[model samples]
Target: MDVFHVTDKDGNKITNEKVIDYIQQSLGTNACLLPSLRRTVGVKAASKHTAIELTGTDRPGLLSEVFAVLTDLKCNVVGAEVWTHNMRVASVVYVTDDSTGAPVDNPERLSMIKVQLCNVLKGDNDKRVAKTVVSTGVTHTERRLHQMMFADRDYERVHNGLLESRDDKFRPLVTLQNCVEKGYSVINIKSKDRSKLLFDTVCTLTDMQYVVFHGTVDSDGPDAFQEYYIRHMDGCPVNSEAERQRIIHCLEAAIERRVSEGLRLELCSGDRTGFLSDVTRIFRENGLSVTRAEVSTRADKAVGVFYVTDAAGNPVHAKTIEAVRGEIGQTILQVKESYSKSPSEETGGRFSFGNILKSTSERFLYNLGLTKSLP
Candidate 1:
């Protein structure tokens, strides 16, 4: 792997220095090659919108209220990612001016936005302080969510006098073992396979100031297994039992934050101001609480995917779902899947979203890559 050889695009070795010299001469003299090039293969362009970070106690209708406040402030939400875990919610929302489509940079307006959002986050009975901040820096959305939740200490278990229990199968198996000979702490995780599973655990370790020297990941059907050899930044392995447990809990929280824990709902409709606010209001009215949400706009259409359960985090009844569908228009908002813990409470069948939206225009389907446009 350390061997070096100069080759053309076709993989043919270039043995002639004259050819290299000619190529260099053809280019300008200002062009110079560095000894090594840092890789940035998957970096995305900077967003032209303002990013707001929010974390607080989770509750029904909280997201709706937040969106309503943003709409009232004339801030248009272009995108957002929301996650809820252990009765704590954290979200990163990207917004722009409704008219200019530019980041809302006015200091006064931003302060008002923060104040209103902070009020909504700090509901009447929240014991922990809610937080709201406007961020000007660029950060990976998902990674930032992990950092925020970690800082908010979402890993701590909450006992709010409710019979809340996570299913054994859904709980991630996290164990830490120290390798004395190798001078590394090994972390092994076994959990159900899903998108970003590795990313969540690695981000947690990285944020905790651990360096992963080596790692291996394997998945079999729905289950995934990961092992990482890591050490502290100070070149030490996990030094104490408390630290080991802390790492384990943090990793579990990271993985669980993104878990969609309820019935999946997909909303496709024409973009409009307060669209999310109205829809989430309907959900709240129907006694549903959003566990996870991904909102985006493409062209003139708004696309949102939400996972929601009963306000108390129990499976929603079939009648409640029917009532919501009837009120929200079944065609515009469809149930894509169900993740209810109780099979008897499941109301929707597993079907492809494209099949459900067959009546939509071909252009819309083409834009979503659900169909190919004919020449």
Candidate 2:
């Protein structure tokens, strides 16, 4: 017999007997022997803000318009994640009542919000219907984004021929084969690796009603290789060519959704209600379209990171960036290094623009009641 040891984060050994007992308690007496029948505990963090889920055709200035609508309705955005892929945009925004600093629970207000946001999402040329939903519950934002895009069928290649024009390096290579003896569909993926690449791929598979029985993920330098042996929920391997194609498409879409394209712009300024709206508007007016955005508020300061490109989904001209930066106050909005850098290389002192933007513009916004008073 070989010896095995288990330990907590602090490295103190957990006795083998205790580990077995814990496993038994977790599985219960009548638990099935198959790994697929096992249950894992999940702990959800409590949140005091209502979440708004939005999905629609993506366009320049769309996010700005969304934020402006929320600001007008007296909603304060505390956190948000925005992703745009293949002309489709999906986001989960967490917000609270500006006056109460609590979740927006009024049915009437929520109804009005839904109507207004739905209108914003449905532009003049959007043939597919846009959707907006408000819920007062804690959810994994990233996972929800994946589900939203999948349901919207963003994996379907756009008719504009943009997918065919992508650089070879950015495109992921995915192959699927059936293993006759094991009764499993084996998927192999090779792509440039970044943070959350595994989570994105695995999450897509799970949401597609597939079970991953075995897998291997290996990273060599910047590239990653993944292989998964999976079966459908009905215990079937991929049976048809169409199903196989869809699985490949979805996995490719999942990997591409989080790839931050274009230049990375980091903004640090005093938190205000209409701050994001104004900044995004500047980008839109300057012919820049945001591809991905992250918004967060820490105390009285607001920090935003945006990946942006030209409205045509190409690299922005240098002069355009300079002009936009000048208009938005060069100190408040600074261009960061490329998003492709590894986490270790990107680490440095943030907030180098000292004093956190206590300028006249901030005071003006505050005077107009756009600034929230933190308790």
Task: Note each model's CA RMSD in angstroms.
Answer: 14.7, 15.9
**TM-scores of all candidate predictions against the true structure:** 0.77, 0.78
Q: Relative to the true structure, how large is the alpha-carbon lDDT of every model?
A: 0.72, 0.73
Off by over 4 Å in 1: 1-47, 159-164, 339-375
Question: Mind giving the per-residue lDDT tens digits that candidate 2 earns over 1-375?
Answer: 111122332234444576557655744776533212111111112357777878888999999898899999999888778988888888877788898888787788888888888888887987876544433333666777888888888898865656535566777999998987668898999988665666689889988889987665655556777777799999989998999999999999998888877889888889877788888889989999989987778889888788899988888888999999998889989887657422211322211111111234334434544333411
Range of the 10 consecutive residues with the lowest summed lDDT in candidate 1? 349-358
Clashes of 1: 0
Q: After superposition, how far is residue 276 of candidate 2 from its true place, in Å?
A: 0.6
* lDDT tens digits, residue span 276-298, model 1: 88888899988999988888888
